[model samples]
Target: MADLHVESTVQDNTDHSPQNNEDVQKCHVVVPTTGMKFESEDEIYSFYNNYAYQMGFGVRISSKRKKPHKTYYALGCHKRGVYESKAESSKQSKSCKTDCPAKISVIVDYDGTCAISCVSLEHNHALSPKKSRFQRSHKKIDSYSKRRLELNDSAGIPLAKIFHSLVVEAEGYENLAFGERDCRNYIAKARQLRLGKGDAEALRDYFVRMQKRSTNFFYVIDMDDEGRLKNVFWADARSRAAYQLFGDVVFFDSTYLTNKYNMPFAPFVGVNHHGQFMLFGCGLVSREDTETYVWLLKSWLECMDGHAPKAIITYQCRAIQGAVAHVFPDSLHRLCLWHIMKKVPEKLGKLNQYKAIKKTLKSLVYESIQSQEFEDGWSQMIKEYALDKNDWLCSLFDDRKRWVPLYVKVIFWAGMSTTQRSEGMNAFFDDYVNSKTSLRQFVEQYDNALKSKKEKETKADFDSLNASYKLMTGFHFEKQFQASYTNAMFKLVQIELQCMLFCNHSLLKTHGTISTFNVTDILRGKRGELKRKVVYTVSFDEVGRDIQCSCHLFEFRGIICRHMMKILIEKDVKEIPSCYILSRWRKDLKHRHYHVINCYEDLKSGGHAKQFEQLCSSFYEVAHIANSQEKYDYLLKCIALAKEKLSDDSSWSVNTNTNTISQDAHIVSEPKKPLLPPAQVRSKGHPPTKRKESKIEQVTKKKRKINVHEANGISSVNDNIYRRSYDFDLNH
Candidate 1:
């Protein structure tokens, strides 16, 4: 048992007088004093213990022996009561001097009893109940929980459900971890139905669905710091899927995402003619080094289900070329003219020269240019520029010829020249993905963007058919052309024939056709030239025995000269060759019925008729404005107005040349005896009398002066010509 004791005593050491006798009696043992009295040690100790306990304090009392007959009481207790009592007294003193406006009472019911509570003089209110502080705080927590529960119920979604949906849409369902929202939702749903607490098989099935769905959500993985591809494993999977769906002929190109110190290499791949970007493969490289190119190609090839591509179209880069040659040896490689054009200035120096170089390089692709011409041009260019004359350039030029006719036809008919399809797709990627984006996000966004663009393009193509058909047979053509006959026109026709032949030959080769027709024959028959008129020229130059015609058709149009046509005609060709018709021009005649008669009607029918109408209107307006006759009339009106304005300005004068006759000059007199000599001569057998000593020199001089005056008059017509230069300068 714990020890418990209380003791108290008081010391008295003074002689008392008779008046103090009453106080002594009041202090006597067992005496009850109504007002106040000295208490014995036992009573004092008991009172202190009770007060200490009430005040939440403990007290100990000790009896001290100060004298033989008297004892002293020493009390020790917590200072809480003393401090609290002093504080109360101080508060009371302050309250007593100040008066509040009105008495305020608060009623409280405790244990079925009513109590009126009022502000005390010592303080604003009674001591605060310790329970009240905790109760107030507890109410706030309860309110918060109640509001949260209400929100959850109204939304009809647990916090876990919302979070799981987000994660499923983000990282995918299969990758959800134990604490992930999806997992929690699955568990909660399962338990709420009184199902088993743990179902490993169900959990596995959920993850499998998530993983399967993740494929639909594409992702691009960039390279890690160690030069390994980071998250883009999906690219490999996607490439395989694409290959399975569509056979090879993938167009690939690389572009930078940012100018930051650390940047990812974005390599994109697209299907052949569909212009669909199947995937964007990205990786980090220290620099665009040879190893990086090799790895990129290898990774892409691997992602392509380890199957060799039939062909790869990309920009011309040495590293890329080398890598392709090494890795995709079987793949026919082609360069994107869009990128090549952008890159040429850096290699050749000077942008202005690009036009000329492009034109020259473009001719290499024309099949009409004989192998001999290509070789000659290649040699000359190499010699002029001191290039290496490598076999690679030769092969490049050779391969370009195979596609040149298609490119020309597409440009002429479809009006699509550059690889803007790829460029536009890349621009879309830049908009959707930024530097800080993770590989996973880039993949999803790129896939979405690609899918969207493809759908848009399909719709656009459908809508564009109307405009394209109109453009193929529009009035603008007639307005733009004037009747003219020139040897150049015939020369161009012959060249066009040769180009057709080249294209047809390529098609024949590609399609394995049995029929063969040369372009030269058709050209000759169309030009009304006989076979005998064809002439072959031999030169010591690279072309050797190649034929040349007076028209120089081959030189101008990079085609077979008309002479070749006459020779081909002598061979007696029958069918029109396929190459003569460009694919762009050779549209399916079946679709001709769909031509839009009215643009508004076509638009109402949901097509690109409105755009087509606007384009046609613009073309017609420009053509009309460019009419020569109208321009000439406008010029004449302007000239008349200018003359009127000049007449109005009195200070303005037309300068005229001054002419004067010199009166100081006189003619010398001649001898008059010349007539007598003429008569003498007549007397002597003279038909010779005609000599007649005439003043012929003076007459000749006069005639010369008259001619000079006439010449001056003729020269005055050129005065306007001189004025033209001044006029031009002023106008400028």
Candidate 2:
């Protein structure tokens, strides 16, 4: 059924308004062009469309195509039909058309210009309200508006702001011929169109390329019954390496909606040597259940070469807990304290002493460092608060070993306290995904986000390699740590060093090679109230040169505790033990750079075949000659010199006017690298205006980050997961 696009009112054909008077008189026909016509079909279309609008009519494409004749390109338009009311006339309502013979046709001349050849300006029936009287003029979002909206979306403009901007651009809401819902729906449809299956294919292709470039780039996709993508798991080379080194303790959190697909994005995170959160792997699950969780956990383990982390942390989820127990029975599973305490007010809000109970519960979680201490504290707090009958408190007590800090203090976490690292993971990719983001948009967004993160890591690496923070303390241990740890870790150790100032240590009894010392901490609070005192027993093994402290800070957090530092100072130890340093956080730890290169997927690429042949020839020759370590070293030096010479060579050196060979020497430039150029993403929509190969765009490739075309599928719970492996070759 034909429908009206917008509101319209009938007018008498005899009316003499300024516009009507002009139309009734000899109508001025603005020709497309008489001499130098437009070359673009869109331009020709635009000219006619504007002409129709001025005549209080709407225009639509009739038939615009090309042929091999003199009129190489032909463009045409016709008057748009209207939706007539039933009350006006039965024939008009049934037909919903005036049968107006108002149309145009343009022919492209041999000069690459278009000239209009046919025009019928007169209409059989009275024209309806300007533009809106047409059957499909309601959603006429111009190219300019779409591009503007796209730019705004990519810039992370809030949707509300985008609406305000579009409305203002149109001058007013009435000019838009649409409400906020229409604009939003248009944006949604646009995004879906651009970010649909092409994006999903793009994501798959990207990971395939990443895996080809590096050895440890791991990814797996589970397909549904129809071979559609169900669940996906992936981890990059650096992440795998990080897992190999620092995956002793892990934090798991993936219960948030990042994309429109409703798939949970779980990130396997751990604490690095420098106390920074390191991502080990990530998974996108269509559903969060025990079987799915199991697959994800097993996939993570597989990527890290079946090496399970000694401990795992997660929120209070029965599915996750069951998965962990089944998959990693040997590894201790801990619960996130943050998630537990967050529900405290809601769980215990009915009590009059809820505030007191909350405070006491927090103190119990943080203060107790031993099983005995925790037990004592829990019993005392519950009794005092009259919570012996509280089911929530009893359940918490029963599950204390999994969540209470005191129970898990002995296990190494590299200083991580909760699964909040997963929250940080969410923040890392939040900028990329929106409520309407599609799978393909996710891929582009994740790539950009990951690149930004790696760039920051590189900057940190530069600081660690070239810069140093000044030492605030003269402690010899501080000097050792500053030399070994990264700048960030050294700063943490420095804080620990400063805290030693308030610590008082005394020697206790010595048993053979083991010497014991008692260290007391006395701290003053902001209100001049002395905080709770803590005394720690430090044990030093003279034979092994190993040190241990009752606080177990090093064992858990990876940093030497204040008590141990005080003891060392008292004993006048010259250096920290070598065993205390972890390599993952070292200043010289090697990391790989993951670069995205343009992979010519088709046979039509320019000059790439020759480049590939040359690369293979050069690498093969080098590998063949450099058989032994000595020969390899010599080749390495030669390669270094070649690189240095290339970096130093200038194309246009300053022409010195000095005598003969020139006595004065010019300053050399910084080191330069031979980097490969990035590939351009295939784009959609209007034919590009620029001549250059479509370069990097804000929304890469075909973009919408769209709201529709969601890939929905489910993997079976009982399906056996086989190990998917790839082979590498020493030769190219």
Candidate 3:
């Protein structure tokens, strides 16, 4: 992106007086120019600065031409680097800023007489309005407004909003001399000054302050041989506690590169009860390698008191895998499902099953419920698709036990399968961090991200501790889950409970205490949905009041699957068996000592909270009054809908209709609209078209198209395809 707008440098009034001013000249060497005589260089420079301001620009003190015993001083536009060749000087200045002929000269003469001259006065760019031109030339924000902006910035306000607020505070748009861009530039300079040079000392200074603020706050920083940062890791006390509660399954991935340094921003994320991404720790490393990974993992493990996660999921990389295996030998290092599926297209492009492979792989990984079933299906796929010879796929199969859902069905992962949470964390920090974000800026941004995530977790914790979630289904077993599970876990359980009603089951086998049922979904699979046909074997220890299903949902997903729930209902098992109630899926995790992080970032977070509440209270009164009027009803409704639509621009839709608001849960009997065709065809704009490529098509090296003509091709004057032959070539 090119910078379209150009500006000239402006300086503030200087204190030194003009050298040729008669205030110091001993009454004889009179001033030659028609400007006010001043005593010192500061006074002379001040006159030039004022002249530059009036001309919509600024001037700087140019170096005086000095000989062996001669001295001369001049003031000119800093953009115009003064030289003997005026053309070259002008060209150099205009190259940086086209059409900006900002040049002025104030020279001290040989007789100690001052001469003021305007060499170049015209400006190509439009001048700022009078109200702001002077202040902008000086680049000074009034002390009060600067303080206000700093206060709001510290409050974590958005930059654009803060600018708008300053505009509002000015009472008039033109009252403020500087633009938003200037305000941003000033803020950047202020932050740079506050952080000092970005180095080990600066980082240590920040960490020391953090430790003083929160005794439990800890950090580990690794430095390179040149005393520069190689890797740094940190975690707060509450975050550590959350890890203790729900860190059994951890997700690791380099979430973003929102810094000038281009550090790998890897965050260790976990799933809270509300299915929100929880930050356990964050690491910024100079590079991705086995050594860096080892150092980061060690720091994280040390912070967690050597309590390793039961499972860790990350994108497949040899360096990360080796480090994980070396450091966390007992923990299951799994492959991210998203990464595996993403790599399939590029890695297996040569295979014949390129088109059907996606569907087959999804079924083989997500649908298959047993290890033996996956083994058989995988082998069959390799044979049918001729994928057995592919080295990449062969390596994947060799490590299937680590990534395939079927093989790890017995381990409890709390339903986490990839660094999708980490990706979301990256997005969460997008509002805070940017390409030019520095170390101090990143710390501030990290606080903002952490605060938002903690707020969500706090909200969920509050709901679990206080509010009662409405039950979607009216069932005793469902109600039991509603009470026992957190809102998020209960939602999953409620979905399974609803699914149990749709399952059509028939007893297939009964031998001793083992019973098998062939469960077929009646409402789904027969239509447009994916087919789900399976036999669920239920082992019932009637004497111990225990039951288990083959789907292993209770064992792995930490939720009772519909298959098992149907069997449990058949067996008249009343409340969820105590053994299946996973505490990790609930807010009430059984940690030795768990602490929830405070949601409010600081005491000043509520600076405008009470004021906003008062406004909301006033609106409530107006809403009540408007509700009584039929005319105001739609208007009030519109306001609410507008608020919702404006609150989240990403999800709100302008085209949402009545059909979209209703659900398919209850069968609504309505007359179907008569089928009609082409009453109104699509507008005659360019019709949508897809460029279909062959299944084997992959991006290869660019090739030029060869146009080989026959040996004796005739060329017509009108035939542009053939070149004209001046003479007979074959005879020669």
Best by TM-score: 3
Clash count (model 3, backbone only): 10
Off by over 4 Å in 2: 1-58, 62-80, 85-216, 224-229, 418-422, 434-436, 524-529, 542-544, 592-732
Per-prediction CA RMSD (Å): 43.1, 18.7, 21.2
Error of 1 at 336 (Å): 2.6
TM-score, every prediction: 0.34, 0.65, 0.65
Model 3, C-alpha of 613: deviation from truth (Å): 19
Q: Could you give the candidate ranking by lDDT, starting with the highest?
A: 2, 3, 1
Q: lDDT at 699 for candidate 1?
A: 45
Summarize candidate 2's per-residue lDDT along 322-367 as a digit string, tens digits. 9999989999888876667766876798899988988888877876
In the range 1-732, model 3's lDDT, one tens digit per residue, is 111222323331322222222212112111113344444456666665665554344555555676543345566554445244375454553232333455444555454545555444444444332432444345567855675666667656767898898888778666776788888887777666655555445556667666766777779977655555667898877788778778988888763443556566788888777767778888877666788789999999999999999998877677789889988999988886556776677776666768797679777877776678888998988888877778877878898887776666667777664223225555556556654556677776677677777677667877886866687655567777777787877877876777677776778877776666776643355364745555556566655667676667677667877877777777776765677776676656644324544332232235485575566678668767775578597767888898888777688558856676647546675763222211111212210111112111211111111212222353322222321221100000
Q: What lDDT score belongs to each candidate, Candidate 1 first?
A: 0.37, 0.64, 0.63
User: Which residue pairs show backbone clashes in model 2?
Assistant: 191-704, 191-706, 192-706
lDDT of 2 at 393: 80
